[model samples]
Target: MNETLKNNTAAAEVDTRETVLEVKDLVVQYVLKEATVEAVNDISFSLKEGEAIGLVGETGAGKTTTALAILNLVPDPPGVIQQGSISVCGNDMLNLDVKELQKIRGKDIAMIFQDPMTSLNPVLVVGEQIAESVRLHEDVTASQAFDRAIEMLELVGIPGARAHDYPHQFSGGMKQRVVIAIALACNPKILIADEPTTALDVTIQAQVLSMMNDLKEKFNTALVMITHDLGVVAKMCDKVAVMYAGRIIESGTLEDVYNTTLHPYTEGLFNSLPRINNKGSELKPIPGMMPDPTRLPKGCAFAERCKYATERCFEERPASRYVNETHTVACLRYDEPDFHIEGVED
Candidate 1:
């Protein structure tokens, strides 16, 4: 039994030397006419090769904005990446020229957006959509691209023969598979799935997630899964980042964050989830709505909602402090000298 435990512990550790994606102190803001809204505050994280990271937060917490910034897809009119750097495969994504970026996008990194219906072009055949993605990234012939598209369809569990059908002809789950096919058409090293299972039924959701897990392993693709579902995070991710407003308030291995939750916002999220074991227990939802991005609070964005918030929390921003080598929390409570709170050992 001791040997088994030791083996499990060894397997859980990730080698950081081979990082696939790196985002450093990224800041993205929307330049609205009335006021500038900071959509993504100074956030930083890294993705290692063939690992999955879950980004969990309530709506308007800037999860989607961060993903958009990674791909340099944030619209310029209202949205802008003000500061920070994003490096994928050692390529500076933010500094890449348009032509260079265009070459790198699908070839090195691809995204499966939130809504499959909108993401897939209704006018075009599903096969053509995937083929176009491949053709754009690689210098392949039309026939070769189409052949690759059919192979991708097969890879995602859809029949290669059905590739000729248009997006409207397939079911919602199938359309999502086609979208995945398009994203993976070039065999990208990184895949960003933003709420990939949101629109599916429970069974189909499970199926899609299973398929994604299988495909990710088969291709050795690093993944960023953006979702509010802690259940999904527990099932799919090696590490997790809990976001509030625009900043990542807590980050660590799945066991570190879930088993020994540090941030009040993260704890509140777990409390809100209905547990099969805790029958009849009242769900404790986090109090207060997300702050308006245009007029954010002076200190911590979650201070008003955090039950454990103190005077320091409302006065100044807390620096990220490491509870250990792998776990970190941006909370004033951790910085309280000689403080020992329940469920936290410092």
Candidate 2:
């Protein structure tokens, strides 16, 4: 960690706000007839009320799996939560019955999935879709729910008259806003947005992100933003947790991770981004690919690609340790005295 950056730890200190969501030692795996896949290895994090955190990494880094686990929606046949606890607003999600879990899904916690086109029911009017969610959770009549749905559409910047429009009638950005409106229809305490802007154009993406941020503030909702885009993370998140393979390699406040990145994987991610000031420079993408989930490395999953990895990194797994009070990283080099990763010069 950079010595100068260590002094800027005020934002990374222990949050005293009420914890809205908590995951402890979560282990999720997919059981197959041929081979078992370790999707999410013992990863844990928490979100306080109205706080936002970005879960960032390459695809198949178990970001979606973690979100599904939080909602207790991981499919039973193939996917399973092998161990750990997920608590939302003090309710134990893992132990709840089907009926009990349904009560919390749309009411307490909501999710905006990856693709908006497939998320909505094409046959149903957009208003009804939102109203259906409202009716399920709130003790409101059909007419009242429909009225609430219209308000939700208007809230997302869509016209109330467009409530009768089907999903196909709206553009890509409009559909996403509808999806967001539905998720926030009942005022969920937590919102998990999994690459909400992936399918939209850059202009629409910016608008949607701004809208979501404003809505989050208005509702005081804790948010978990899962994406591969560091740019999105910087704009919307207070804290960041970088994932690799199936575990969190590094995590801290935006300032801590961005200014004083600890893990080599995190460094690689930053290096891969195109710099505005140095437009002519070539991007430095991480070498090698993610390890096979079915047969993950015995030690560090990132050792093969990390420039700083030693023989010890390939043999012994490193435990997550806090460099400062709130900044945590899982690299063996942190155990060495006065060690720091030297930045690569262009």
- Measured by TM-score, the strongest candidate is 2
Candidate 1: tens digits of C-alpha lDDT, residues 264-334: 88877887778777687777787879999999999888899877888888989887888887899999887
The runs of at least 3 residues in candidate 1 whose Cα sits more than 4 Å from the true structure, single-residue gaps closed, are 1-17, 337-346
Query: Residue 120 in candidate 1 has what lDDT?
Result: 88
Scored by lDDT, model 2 comes in at 0.93
Clashing pairs in 1: none
Error of 1 at 135 (Å): 1.2
RMSD (CA, angstroms), candidate 2? 4.2
* Model 1 TM: 0.93
For model 2, residues 129-195, the per-residue Cα lDDT tens digits are: 9999999998999999999999999999999999999999999999999999999999999999999
Predictions in order: lDDT: 0.90, 0.93
Question: Residue 227, candidate 1: how far off, in angstroms?
Answer: 0.6
Clashes of each: 0, 0
